[model samples]
Target: MEKHSNVKSRRKHISPVFHLQTKKEEDQHITKEVIKSVRRTGQLNLSSRHIATVPEKLFSIYDAEDENTVDWDFGKPKKEEDAWWNINPLSHLDLSSNVLSEIPAQIGMFQDLLVLNVIFGIII
Candidate 1:
C-alpha cells in the first residue's frame, strides 16, 4: 500500500442575520463622566428622535485623518479620539431629541466620541 496526502479547500460564509443579531445594545448604567471627556475641545450635535438603534452598516464610515468639520445642519456625532479604540467610534451612538428627559447612560460606550448636537428638540 502507498501513502497518500489528502487536502481540502473551500471558502466559508456566514449569514447576515447572525452578524446583525450579535451587536448588543449597551446597558443603562453608563455614566456621563466617562462620556464627558470626549465632549471637550470639539463641538457636539444632538439629533431629534434618533432611530431605535445605531445600524451595523455605519461601522465602515471611519476616516482617521479626515479632520473635516462636522456639519452643523446635519448635527453629526463624531469621535474625539485620533486612534481606533478597537471599535468604530461612530457606531452605536444615541442622539435623542430635546424632548428626552435624560440621555441614556448607555451612551458611554462611545468612549472616543466627540460631538453631540441638538437638531429639533432640546435636551432637557
Candidate 2:
C-alpha cells in the first residue's frame, strides 16, 4: 500500500482591492465604541467566545461588590425574543453580593445593564 500526499504545497493567491465610499456613508458604517476596563480578578474566567469580537459594537457593565462568578462577570446578556439590543451595549456588570433593602432609582445610570447580579447577604 502506498501513502498518498494529498497536501498542496502552494500558497493561496491574494488580491489587493479597494472600494471608494462617501465620507457620510463611511461614517455611518462605523459603530460607536464603549469604554473598556481590564479586570484581573482571580475567580472569573474568560468565555470561549468574546462579545468584543462580535461584528457590531459591544459595551460592558459591572457590579461594584462582586468578586466571584464568571458568567455574570464577563459578558452581557443577549436581547430576549421580545426585548431588543440597545444602541449602547452593556457587556459587563458586577452587581454581586451587595444586596440592599431596595435598589435605588439611580440604577438607571447603567443604561446597558446586561449582567445585573443581586446577591443577598446573611445578616447574622
- Which predicted model would earn the best lDDT? 1
The runs of at least 3 residues in candidate 2 whose Cα sits more than 4 Å from the true structure, single-residue gaps closed, are 1-90, 122-124
Where is model 1 more than 4 Å wrong at Cα? 1-46, 50-87, 91-98
Q: Weakest 10 consecutive residues, lDDT, candidate 2?
A: 49-58
Number of clashing pairs per prediction, in order: 10, 10
lDDT scores in order:
0.37, 0.31
Model 1: worst 10 consecutive residues (lDDT sum): 1-10
Q: lDDT value for candidate 2?
A: 0.31
Tell me the tens digit of each residue's lDDT in model 2 across 1-124.
Answer: 1223323322234432423334343233223221222222111212222111111211222332236743443344543321223223443443333312344455566554556444342112
Q: Tell how far residue 11 is off in model 1, in angstroms.
A: 64
Tell me the tens digit of each residue's lDDT in model 1 across 1-124. Answer: 1222222222224333312122242212122433343223222233432333433323323333236754545333464343234333433243544344445555565556555443454445
